[model samples]
Target: MNVKGLDYTCLTLSIIGAINWGLIGIFRFDLVAFLFGDMSWLSRIIYTLVGLSGLYLISTYGRICQVDDAR
Candidate 1:
């Protein structure tokens, strides 16, 4: 995928991860763990994907700034 597409995907995943964290923080609950079994293989994979997406998004900072500058 192109940079923009990748960025969008990463951002989406990061947002989902953030929301999950929010839920955990406020309610002491884990949606992924609830849906899947607590720390199941599938849940671990989801956590890993979310973490990787967050790392990928870190690299998009420059592009984000450039876009803002253009506006």
Candidate 2:
């Protein structure tokens, strides 16, 4: 995927992860687990992907700053 596509995907996953964390903190609920069984392989994979997405999103800060500077 192109950078923009990848960025969007990462952002989306990161947002989902954040929402999951919010639910966990507020209601002791895990949306992934609720949907995919408790700590199942699929749930673990989802968690891992979310984490990687978060890491990928870290680079977005520099990209955003560069874009702003370009204008």
Candidate 3:
């Protein structure tokens, strides 16, 4: 199966969230908080979106398996 545009978006957001987590672990820095404000509405929204994107990406495992199996 081919990946959809929504999958691309979710994957991108997940990557961004992962990067933010890495920064927090390594440097106690938060890119989202810095850009949007600490726990502000915008930051919360971004956090929520990133969380949702991570959740959505979980479902992609089956799609990925199908593509790999085809190959």
For every candidate in turn, the CA RMSD to the true structure comes to 1.7, 0.9, 2.6
lDDT, candidate 1, 1-71, per-residue tens: 99779888888888989999999999999998999889999999999999999998877788779999999
Local accuracy of candidate 3 as per-residue lDDT tens digits, 1-71: 35688898888999999999999999999999999999999999999999999998888888889999999
Better structure of 1 and 3 per TM-score: 3
TM-score of 1: 0.85
Task: Report the number of the highest-TM-score candidate.
Answer: 2
Which one is best on lDDT?
Answer: 2
Q: Candidate 2: where is the Cα deviation over 4 Å?
A: none
TM-scores of the candidates are 0.85, 0.92, 0.86
Q: Rate the local accuracy (lDDT) of all candidates.
A: 0.91, 0.94, 0.92
The C-alpha local distance difference test score for the whole of candidate 2 amounts to: 0.94
lDDT of 1 at 6: 88
The pairs that clash in candidate 1 are: none
When sorted by TM-score, best at the front, the candidate numbers are: 2, 3, 1
Clashes of 1: 0
Separate clash counts for every candidate: 0, 0, 0
